[model samples]
Target: MADFKSIKVTKGIKTLEIDNPTGYHLIGMGAQGAVFKLSEDRCVKIYTSPLQAKMEREALKAGQHLSFFPRLYEYGDNYNVIDYFNAPTLKEYLRNCTYIPESIAMKLLDILGEMKKAKFTMVDAPLRHIFVLENEELKLIDHVNAFKRIHPVPLKLLRDLNMMLLKESFLSRVKKLEPKTYEMWQAYFNENKMDYRNIPVDPGGDGEGVKVDSAISQTLIGAGHQGAVYRVSENKCVKIYPKTQHCEQEKDVLLSHQDLSFIPKVYETGNNYVVMEYLSGPDLNTFLKKQSALPPVVSKLLLKILTSQKQAGFKQIDAPLRHVFVTNNGFKMVDHVYSYSRIQKRPLELFQNLHERGFLDAFLEQVKVLDPATHAEWTKKPIPLTDEEAQLEIINIEGKTDSKRKKGKDQGKDRDKGRDHKKGHNRDRDRSQKREHGGKRDNGDKKNRNRSKEHGRENDRKKRSDRIK
Candidate 1:
């Protein structure tokens, strides 16, 4: 008997490392643990954690009745001895083949049905975990979460198909053969505002260059603080920047990554402009606003872009929502000015933008389902509040402007009241002065009348005296 206790397993940042001192032949290794072939028909799987080993053992014991699952012979604290078959993984098969056949799709669906029959809550498995046997049959491994987690759909399986460019064909088969399941999946996608039928299989643009003249007039497609984009041809657009350095930076990034499917193909470069493939679609911000939901497809595409950028050795993996375009082919990102100069491990700006748009929670949920490791790593750190702060700063500026406007209005009202009060006071004073003047004139007239009457009486008396004399 081989001593499984002699084997040592250490947990790393993202995966487990194993130190095997025994004569067991190493078959495979993953984040959970390592597998070693014990015999011609059996293998032993050792887990880094006993809890995970226990979970898989129980799940395998429960699923032993199904032909798709391996037969378990024995299980210990952190290891399981199960029947093993030398077969290629579905991922490897797909890599060699151009497209998935209908028979394979049907078999996959049947496996899911069998899992459902077995009462496994999580019917999902990655392509790499499924082994393709000789008779077009499937065998699934890594049953740790089969009974523990509850997922309504095979999200991870569908994600794998999407990544392999085989989802459309598989869904077509589902739509014809398993209409009910297809409807359920479609409803789920619809709820998330995702159009799974039109998932991008290839990157947009042909490897062709476009010609442009600086003096020629072109239709202005977009304008921003950095530059202006104008449509020079039906399939090409020219982005002209005010600064040559900015143009040089963007052009260099684009030229270096021309083979990438999601990147826009570069045609020509000038002192301050670069002609590239014209991307025809709404920006990510506009799409989210229009749909009012963050679709799982968008989250997957964003994660894929980040992974590709990392693989291509880009330092800055973040992009604003406005810079990401949702085209018919796939998601395309523009503005690579910071991709080389800035060092960022995660897409903090993108997450902040999602947070500001009220889609952060939904995006994170999708991430948690599609890529748990990424979700763990991203949630482990704090997402910076730069976008939030920018939004708040805008609100504050508008608030201050409103307050100033209101204050100016109030001050104008106060000045108007003062002017009215002064006018009323002056009018009253003029009325009083007029009244006094009129009273004096009336008194003077009265006195003159009396004097005239007295003079007349004296004249009459003098006349009478003269007559008498």
Candidate 2:
């Protein structure tokens, strides 16, 4: 066996990398760490956390004498050396046999019986965790949790076996052979309905549950509405969610759309986080912005993607270009909340923003120039634009209409005020003329009175002169 001191372990996920991996063969891996085959008789388990490694080592020591488990030779802080058995795992057996016989279930119970006698208990024996030798004997691996008290009922094994073997065939076989035992297992499942493997841990935000890709120099890729995304490895990335429920919902969405080419493959899901295949390309919006023009090939690809999405019963075609990546594999949509969630529709701002950013015309031009046939067909039988986009247009039209109405009202008020002012001027002119005319008539009467008086005075004077004569 190689000295574990020489085996380089990367700190991020605590993955084991040999100085020269030429002779070593990778056997398996899990959430904790990995296992590697060193030779015909020797294999080693390496863990990411020292605590986990210590627990595994102690558990192995407690059951070192038990034949049902692997023989541990020596253990370090992060590595364990053990005898590698040349046999097929229970998972492989199921894949080949398609079903587990009743007799095999009985055999497993008998094996569990021996472990119970040794006071080493392991209830979570998924088919994948157990190995079956050519001699039909069994060797259970992953002894980390063996120290827990043995439950009278094998709850973990029952659930895991059912999940690993479709239709719960193994548990069902046990049920038929031992009705009482099956009832106990079924009762246990009902009581503990939660599957820890699928249960999400609250990511809270920063790529929750994300492990460092310590092997790489820089891992931060980008962020979205869900949370920040980080590159964990060459092939994997993690998206942390704002809320725990969002992670669960997103996981369900990803699983439902696994067949779609435009969506990323979801790997591991945490409480508020998801690990998925990392896409290697710039988003369409950024790419188009940088190019300042769209190529004909890009148009054809984008249309084809939208057409495929529509055919897949996904009606929302007005995808935000920023959520779209232009890769050689095809367009990969990293976000799917709008597609599968309750929203069920794309917002109109997606298109409006593209138009506002001056990319809509460029994209349309490419479509018209390159895929004219598709453009014609789409335009003629245009996909029904969502009501969301219409609301934006309505708001714009309403704003302009309100502005025009206000201006018209102001103009009307001004015109009415001008007419009133002209009428008042004519009234003033008439009043002045009337007053002048009255004054002129009074003066003429006065002159006439004076003339009459003078005539009277002349007559009086004539009378007085006559009287004097």
Q: What TM-score, computed on C-alpha atoms, does each candidate reach?
A: 0.45, 0.47
The worst-scoring run of ten residues by lDDT in candidate 1 lies at 417-426
Give a tens-digit lDDT track for model 2, residues 131-166.
777666777777776775455556445533433334
- Residue pairs that clash (backbone atoms under 3 angstroms), model 1: none
User: What ranges in model 1 sit over 4 Å off?
Assistant: 96-98, 194-469
| Candidate 1 C-alpha error for residue 193, in Å | 3.5
Against the true structure, candidate 1 has what lDDT? 0.64
Candidate 1 per-residue lDDT, tens place, 273-303, comes to 7888877666676678766788788898998
